[model samples]
Target: MNRSFPPLFLFLLLIGCARNSEPTTVATETADDDWWKESIVYQIYPRSFQDTDGDGIGDLNGIIERLDYIESLGVTAVWLNPIYSSPNDDNGYDISDYRNIMTDFGTMADFDRMLAGMHERDIKLIMDVVVNHSSDEHEWFVQSKSSRDNPYRDYYHWWPAEKGDPPYRYSLFDAEGNAWKYDSTTDAYYLHYFSQKQPDLNWSNPKLRQEVYDIMTFWAEKGVDGFRLDAFQFAAKDTTYPEFPGLTDTTFIDYYAMQDGLHDYLREMNEQIFSKYGVMSVAEGAGRNFEDAHALVDADRQELNMAYAFDGVDVPKYGGYALTTMKEVFSRWDAEFAEDGWLSIFLSNHDQARMVSRWGNDSPEFRAPSTKLLNTFLLSMRGTPYAYYGDEIGMTNIDFDEIEDYQDIAARNGYTKARAQGKDMEQFMRELNFLSRDNGRTPMQWTEGPQAGFTTGTPWLPVNDNHAQINVAAQEDDPNSILNHFRQMTRLRQDHPVLVHGSYELLLPDHEELYAYTREWEGVRMLVVMNFSDEGVTVDLPELENAEVVIDNYESLSRTGSSADLNPWQAVILSL
Candidate 1:
């Protein structure tokens, strides 16, 4: 029998008016005005979410079957990692076709079914659009490499190496190696900022830029709500190819991809194409800072509605192994993006380690509390929350004994590099196993059954070993389960508009063990307090005397006095 609670009726009542009422005023045309800013997005790594065809890979049909589960969480949108045709290098980041659904991920018909399902439930779908580069096997790249005189030759960045100077610098290679690779057929060097198999598109070529715009229009016309732009900052490179400083004896080319005119191009795309379709656009600027974040999302910028801000999430690996304190990371995030532009807050993704294993203690003894604590902290923050598959059930990282067991290219490359450096295989594998993307890429644990109920066959990536104990089926009936906590957190955000878009204020900023903040809008005030420590603590709450406890981690909250006493890893939301 299926089991799930429809969100409390009172919660629905609170948000119903706003959702059902027609707006009195029409806003100016801009990307920021897209419906996505008012949405709660759930990020799904397609290959790991679920499999309906028993092919061991999650496909569009599986997502269609799971729309009920997604809706239960109160999220209004889903951001799917690439499902386009690809060679699976970089796990679908290397797109070979901009318009086709990958065969492994099912046919175009399956994609239509998924979209129909989501739309039927009032949920929107956002697809990943990788424009920075395309797979070397792409038709354009193939033609470009076939002959120097091919019309497609200018579609990609190509430069001849100077007589005495070294080649352009590619970020993927080590020892200041050339970014360009010479093809015997074409006899010219092609640029690849990432893997050599992924050729960077020459945005300087108007034809290529227009082609990307056309691709966006094609998808938008097909009913997609919007796009999550992949590696958006790396779209354009310096045409002059100036050598960068800091590399010895090697001519390192500074790829000026995010230069001045980049905004103009983005503005044109937003105004001419995206605005017309009313599609939300979010760019993945992995290395951007506060200023860049504002520019990417500010209402007047007309570039993108928002971008993934990774400042706190990518904290330096602690002790070169474990994750650092959540206090340090979250405080920095609170200070960084607290001003104008919105943030896309997330704990784990298809490319990062599972939060439970990387940050929270994943052992049975500490797993429940740690998961609850992390969820409270993440959802209460001032931004759209993106929950990765299996995160709600506190999935742990995969433990693989052999290097051959890994599927992620980045992890395999790191392992190979470690082995070449003569590092101890056992120790290196242990660390790699912990930090690898494979940790987050494990198939979702749906139930305590064969293949964790994710697939009927062996999964493409291994399922977590503790699936039986931590599966969704085991937690569905428990109100205190992490899944239920996630439901409540999302419900609270939906019920209270202040929680979703209010100005955030960090209270007691120096408190090491407590992450306390207020979300105030108009005259409504809501305080979110989280205890990040392992021990019980007490803090005076004179400022919150008028506040009534609205939600608490535990059943009972101390309402006898002005101050609040918190148990270890406790969290509560109070409103005035």
Candidate 2:
């Protein structure tokens, strides 16, 4: 022992000490050094994307098999929906364990393989991180619920019944009463915002915060490039639990989960965990306003790199009214957070209906025109664009004949609520057909085969009947297919600086059926002209007199004139 340690050991010790003595470079840990901020992200709902085990559910291996296809689309990254161990209460939004891959999806080895394959293709992988709440079945939740005095009890939000106040009074519940459920074994009520099985996490506790931070670090160490924070705005709540002013007088309680200090916690998480891993953190603030959103992603705040803004894309369908007009919606987004922060522009996601059916036409005759128009508007906007799986092929929503055809909790709940409200069955069914998550969750249309080539057996959800006509195999051969158009759009965005990180100015602001905008960046100006109607229209383009046609939906476009005539549902990209 007195002979001294080996030279190799001493050398390693000296290197470690030198590393500790060196100054830590924060910029090296920030993903802003990468090009992810300007990249297009394609979202894949794993269970519905592909299946390799013939179990009717997608697995990591299935995604690995489709790496080439994903890369061929010209997308820079893929934001996978939750693939962690879960009971599927909210379709993987409720995590039982953060470190393990769901048995249904595949093993941890399969995940690593997929990550490696994506890396080889130069594609970034953004995992979905659901930290707002954990599944009731989670070990921490189970231990927390074991005893009121348990050391883990504070891991989740637990409350006692107020005097003379019903223990059942809670938010998010219908006639069933409180969202909190009493555990017989624990003899305490646990809070849940979405479902009884998903208990809200107590972020007020420092230990719980550290546990979450550790979990994020675990994944970061395992080579996760980034994360899409699920329902991130709901992470912090008002500790006082004060009742809304209207709650005493009316049944409507305007309870907002994103209270004060949420941004502080988010910024801390970014600085401590994500920043260290060089990961891109995107927050999902579904119902936040421009003020809150701007603060969350403002470069100076360093809370989030970007957030998913639902305001512009959630077109209401009440009274035969298409919520906000396209102009009003896009202009609001263009004016609000354009200068301060980045926006995640998306038309469809796992929670929403298929964009081709909801925003575009679903019929055979009008589908192509509407799909192209929608894509033109989305890609031309000044932000990062996210395309849902199967969107490139112009996929339509699945038409289920019965309630049993659906597996989504939200869809089933909506159907029951619709009928309980005495709504007309036909209208209710139509709404369900249009708005259900099943519409977007249907197995990806891969080919004309059993289960649409997504799985060997029956899919977890039924494949759309039109898969035979619109499958990826068929469209891949057609250069003018919707899938090819999407590739072209992405390529153009990559080639043109004005399309990404540019200033947007709306043209023809009052035009109902015409959506036109100019994107100017570093002296390069490009105009996007789109006709949202089915009839041809002539628009004055005096500002584009010297502009030449760069891209158009139709082959023939008039380039020599100041004012150009547009065909029915036509779009053109012009540049000077």
Candidate with top lDDT is 2
| lDDT of candidate 2 at residue 19, scale 0 to 100 | 11
Across residues 1-576, which tens digit of lDDT does each residue of candidate 2 receive?
Answer: 011100110000000000111111111121454466578899999999989999899988999999999999999999999998999887898899999999999999998899989999989899898887899999999899888888999999887544223233343322232556767675567777657888989888889988999999988998888888886676787766655432210122124445777877887899887778889888775334566666877788877878677655554342232312546676666666555677788887887778877776668876776787778777887777888998888898777778778787755655665577677988666666666777888889999987889998878878889988889998898887888888889899889867876677777767766778787776778889987666778888786698887878777665446887887668889886
* TM per prediction: 0.88, 0.90
CA lDDT, candidate 2, residue 192 = 76
Can you give the lDDT of residue 27 in candidate 1? 21
Model 1: per-residue Cα lDDT over 51-169, one tens digit each: 98899999888888889998988788999999999998888999999899999899998888889889999999988999888999899999998877899999998764444343445
Lowest lDDT block of 10, candidate 2: 9-18
Structure candidate 1, residue pairs in collision: 236-257
lDDT of the candidates, in the order given: 0.72, 0.74
Q: Alpha carbon lDDT of residue 519, candidate 1?
A: 74
